[model samples]
Target: MGTTGGLADDRALLGRTSTAERVADILRTRIAEGYFPPGTRLSEENIGGALGVSRNTLREAFRLLTHERLLVHELNRGVFVRVLTVDDVVDLYRTRRLVECAVVHGLGGPPFALDGLAGAVAEGERHARDGDWKGVSTANIHFHSELVALAGSERTDELMRGVLAELRLAFHVVDDPRALHEPYLARNREILDALRAGERTKSEQLLADYLDDSRTQLVEAYARRVADDGETPH
Candidate 1:
């Protein structure tokens, strides 16, 4: 399919607010949803037409995502979704550990607005039951996004939005979504349950351990895939 296939519906989102940032958001979500996998060249003409935005606005959006490390503009070449390196995988997890663990540790008490976390856990279970591992992976990302929301900081949420989207680029390298996402679903529930019970310390520990296991799993899988493709690890 072309880059802009079936993007007509997305035009409605920009009907009222057609800022470059909004366009960047729509593109970012598409990238995270695997609509535009790593290395796929983005067609500015097609995308701008489909989104009903001007070339200048689209370029600005591209620049924004490039800054976020989700897209890259090559000299004399078009912008493309970035293919993450093994080192990128490792660094992403390192950042996740620092940010996510800190968010969990900073929670003062129970009654942390956990509805979002619970919803994500349930969403993952639903997708798992339907044999949709990719859906499970997406929900797993959502679970963490909601977990970070516990901190109630808009800045942190915005930062993780980009980080998690970049992490999805790494996830695209994994051939087996079930293996990558299944184990973590239960672990997500464990963390949420602990939080609901006001066991902030236990939740933090579980989250720390969970991030460690996930980091290990992704790094190994991503490294092997990069090697198979003959790309040097950065």
Candidate 2:
């Protein structure tokens, strides 16, 4: 009886972890697929009941997503999907330009991580061709993340991770991953090419333009989404 009880306890623990992960994936997919629009309230009770999990497990999953910036928790109100504003877009691009451009320019000398960037770009191309827009988005983010990782700063990588998470939320709202990412596929290749050729200045300039274009496109799409939904801008 004691051994059987211990086995049951282990299984229960495993089940809880699995439940949390399942909840996280469901929330992430819904957010990415735009089922729950930005600013949609996430009720723990409702979500847990719908997902067939207890409230404690749902809250644990919510905490993880909140840290990732995919959800925002409000005091007394409850958690909601984060709404990316125009000002947020502007600030996000400003930081991206400052950080990414410098990283590209600073790789003037050899010993750069062009190989990682190449791999990410290649994976993105494959996913793009396979019509896996979500996979393409993941690979695209990996490409830029690799570029920043080349700078060899843990702090920089952490900041970029947060920025990219927020950007992903914005992409979710747009609901057209191909429209948002297809244009940048070749831009990523060009950036990699410049880096390989050791043209730091050229790469930096190209990246700046790419970021500007991306910001403009994403902001316009988000505005249209908001208008269509008749939701006030955050």
RMSD of each: 8.3, 5.9
In candidate 1, stretches whose alpha carbon ends up further than 4 angstroms from where it belongs are 1-18, 231-234
How do the residues 46-141 of candidate 1 rate in per-residue lDDT, one tens digit apiece? 999999988888998999899999999888888999999877888998999999999999988667889999999999999999999999998999
Off by over 4 Å in 2: 1-37, 46-68
What TM-score, over all chains together, does every model reach?
Answer: 0.89, 0.77
Per-candidate Cα lDDT values, in order, are: 0.90, 0.85
lDDT of 2 at 233: 41
